[model samples]
Target: MNAPTATLHLLPEVNQREVPAALIEALKARFGDQCSTAQAVREQHGRDESSFEVPPPAAVVFAESTTDVADAVRLASQYDTPVIPFGAGSSLEGHLLAVQGGISLDVSRMNQVLSINADDLTVTVQPGITRKQLNEEIKATGLFFPIDPGADASIGGMTATRASGTNAVRYGTMRENVLALEVVTASGDVIRTGTRAKKSSAGYDLTRLMVGSEGTLGVITEITVRLYPLPEAVSAAICSFPSIEAAVRTTIQTIQLGVPIARVELIDHNTVRMVNAYAKLGLREEPLLLMEFHGSPTSVKEQAETVQEIASEFGGNAFEWASTPEERTRLWTARHNAYFAAVQSRPGCKAISTDTCVPISRLADCLLDSVAETDASGIPYFLVGHVGDGNFHFGYLINPEDPKERETAEALNQKLVMRALKLEGTCTGEHGVGLHKMGFLVDETGAGAVDMMRTIKRALDPKNILNPGKIFAL
Candidate 1:
């Protein structure tokens, strides 16, 4: 648990390429006021929630349609300038950073629900439509999208990151829910992949390829995803445990027993206290599991009973149910705000988050060992997880000005990732391999597989103008 002396170099070396005046001129001419060179606009679009600092992009293009995106990208191609797609800017990794100077193609203006096939259980939306907005727009249809991701991230950003969240245990992640896409490739050509159909065996599976490409492959202009009917019966509950191991064990047993849990989240004692302080809630300060069930009324009751039995076996306290919709919303909102709460606890500190996922059977081993090591290291941290799916996060709060704390936090992250890999898990469960996890990507996927990725990137983006210097160094 000793802190390593050398820091983990998370940010890539900045190699800003020039954005010629001619390119900016062409953009302004084509889109008029939609193209901006103001420092505020450029700076706002250049960064995300990641703890990295770099120069802002030279210009920002507020694209309102596919044609706008294509034209802007086409112009950038001419100047060999990078075009980094911008969504809601909720990405935890450095996915939105302009490490290599480029134009920030802001798509937040394109928010719209283009079509809703209620009968087919599918909805197509513009890339900038946020998840919350999508659900509100489609609520009249008695259906909703389930990939929450905590943040009200844009659908395009979620699709790019292959994101999942609390309900992922039952409804699945973006990788499984997304049915098709309309992407603007590096050459600024608009192409469609897949269809409204549930499954396909087409050539190359390009839609799957683009789903987790993290904007390195292309700009996601439109997305068609599956939706589910509002559950007939729903119930939410919280159960506190004496220790993290007991809570994790309860989750392991619940999933092992084949319960169809809609959402199962773990918040360690540290995070629980933070959430209480930030949200002004009266939740018990202990390792806690917040869960929800969905199905017929009889089935929901049975599922809850079964889970309660399992929890009791693991020394879990009596359940605290949040049955009303308002109650459930308030509870989940606090859980989503856990990261912000932790950051607020340590003023002027930035969080370096980890996203490692392992098999359901190995959840206890991977999490408990890491918890012990982190405790011994003496770095302030917050732990939360979608443990039903064996995916979790550890947010290490470090002062930006403190070099020693940064090194210690990064060192802890490296050990945790390597341990997850050893347990046959992935370095990233949802967050893509942005600048922060590039080296671990190599370790997890091996040199040969990463080389194959490089080959595909080169073929698609010969000039490397589409989100240059991301995923891997080309």
Candidate 2:
């Protein structure tokens, strides 16, 4: 398949669209101290963790409340300008690109834990509050938010990306934890969806809709998330496998046996090498499984023993446990930075990461095939995943200036997506289409379902201005 000559369009959030000086002054006057047009600030908002770089917004509006976000949206709409909500800008898929930049609705200023209903095991937080911050604030309440995207990313950004990490195998993704949201629509309408109750047969389930909308449907100003009680016991370990096939096969067996594994991550030999070099860890360069056990002491012991038994059958080594909190934190921290490790392997190279998930039964075949396909090139790459959930990522290293390397990476990604679809998986496990996966979305979901999505998008954002040129363009 030939790739399109899309020219890597420039949508710099700072200069993508013209914002009148008068409009800037007006916003500053109305919000007073909340609006900033400084060059550094604009430049910061212009870029994201995504490989693509675009223009920054004309001015950054540091929203302090839902009313503040609504006001900013109203002003942006009045000028017929595009508005992009800015969280931590950790979006790996260009979800926060200010394609038609106008005003970046920066939500970091609204970092506040509005309420924590421990009785209901729910917490309402301003969109700017990050998962790390929320957990810190709720630490004493005996309840914790378990959707760990690995990064200390803002909850709003996590929700926008429908992020999930190693913990996703046990705790689920943003799709399961986010109970409700307060969204500010394109028309500046404030709407609430979902309730504190555990379950709701409520009309429409709109909250769930926006949770993974990737900032296309609306700008989430507030979020209510379900929380879980801290387990009575927890343990983490790094286990080495003889080969990638053995590691993946053992994971499938564990899942098939219903071991209730909290987290099961696969790190291929290539990734293990990258992590060792990047994090300065001394370990044998082999396929590794980073496992975590969470439950009562007896339950955790039983779970670990069950995993050990399966691993032994696959020629696995004994678990090298990280007993201390610091050890566990450092281990997971390195895992979360896997992409960075891959990118750093080749200086000045950008990382192109793809997420593909397959059925547990086919996980071994899927991973082995994908790993082989990637290894055939011998390109500097890393393979890491939440294997227990059948989701994995291939972080491809590319020199953006070298057209061959870049295009080859894209082609490789497309092929990986194809293989995942063949195995009854999705083009994306957590990351939404944003712009990177638009073509793949069509391939995975077909043109008919894509059409229905476009229709709904048109109905909600009739002007096609909410997030122009994203998901689909008709």
**Cα lDDT listed for each candidate:** 0.92, 0.82
Off by over 4 Å in 1: 1-7
How much is 383 displaced in model 1, in angstroms? 0.7
At residue 237, what lDDT does model 2 achieve?
80
Clashing pairs in 1: none
Model 2 Cα lDDT, one tens digit per residue, 304-409: 8889888999999957877568888776755776777778888998888888999989898788888888888766788888889999988888787877777778
User: Judged by TM-score, which candidate is best?
Assistant: 1
Worst 10 residues of 1 by lDDT: 1-10
Clashes per candidate (backbone, < 3 Å)? 0, 10
Tens-digit lDDT string for candidate 1 (243-272): 999999999999988999999999999999
If scored against the real structure, what TM-score would every candidate get? 0.98, 0.94
Predicted structure 1: lDDT: 0.92
